[model samples]
Target: MLLPLLVALLPLSAHAAERQVVLIAHPQVTNAALTRDTTRAIFAMRQRSWPDGQAVRVFVLPNNHPVHARFAKERLTVYPHQLQLAWDRMVFSGTGQAPSQVGSQIEMLERVATTPGALGYLEREYLDDRVQVITME
Candidate 1:
């Protein structure tokens, strides 16, 4: 019974390990790393500037996107619905704005790469030289 259970779980574990989500930023952004709290604040749109005082332009996938959900839960330690609620509240209250939403991961990569001081997240498989991976400290 134990052996069968282990075998049954192996593929799920392997698939989980394979889908690594990472924070990515434009190369022009000076910061190389950020604390998870700061990252969360940025994604939440509560924090608007990088530590160096450069204006931060945040990009994101739609709330229903799988990568967006995973990144919100795994990296930011928040649920996608919670993030959406926060954004909606901000918009309705007129106190802040939501991040720009891209239709796909490829668009995310393109926007982050081309926009100065842009920050976003992507799966490991989608990474390339166009954007720099920001280490989450």
Candidate 2:
């Protein structure tokens, strides 16, 4: 009885769970020296591209986006609200602004894939052979 119901709902749940925005770089990207702090710096536009020689562009999900929440916590090492405070703090301190935000995972994926020198995040589920996944190493 319940088994059939659970089986029926599994696909929907799997679909819903497919929203992880993996950071990515170009296929020609050769350097793997980026750490979370460095990645944050680059994504925030605080730092530029790799020393190995590639143009740099940064991207992000929208301000209130749930995809951004994971990035804010895990990579940026701050909460969304806290990150907002950090940006404000930086602004007053004569520092930099945050990365420009895209509206959705699909948009982010498309932008980064099509734009040269671009870097961005989109749900891992949305990833294909189009972009090269950038890992923090």
Best-matching candidate per TM-score:
1
What TM-score does prediction 1 earn? 0.87
Tens digits of per-residue lDDT, candidate 2, 1-137, equal 99999999999988766755578865566754468887776765667667666767777776688778887777667677766665677667877666667888778878877877778777778788878888776
The models' CA-based lDDT, in order, is: 0.94, 0.74
Pairs clashing within candidate 2: 20-123, 20-124, 21-122
RMSD after CA superposition, every candidate? 2.7, 3.6
Stretches off by above 4 angstroms in model 2 are: 1-18, 85-98
Model 2 earns a TM-score of 0.72
Across 4-116, the per-residue lDDT of candidate 1 in tens digits comes to: 99999999988776678889999989999999999999999999999999999999999899999999998899999999999999999999999999999999999999999
Model 2 poorest ten-residue lDDT run: 25-34
Maximum-lDDT candidate? 1
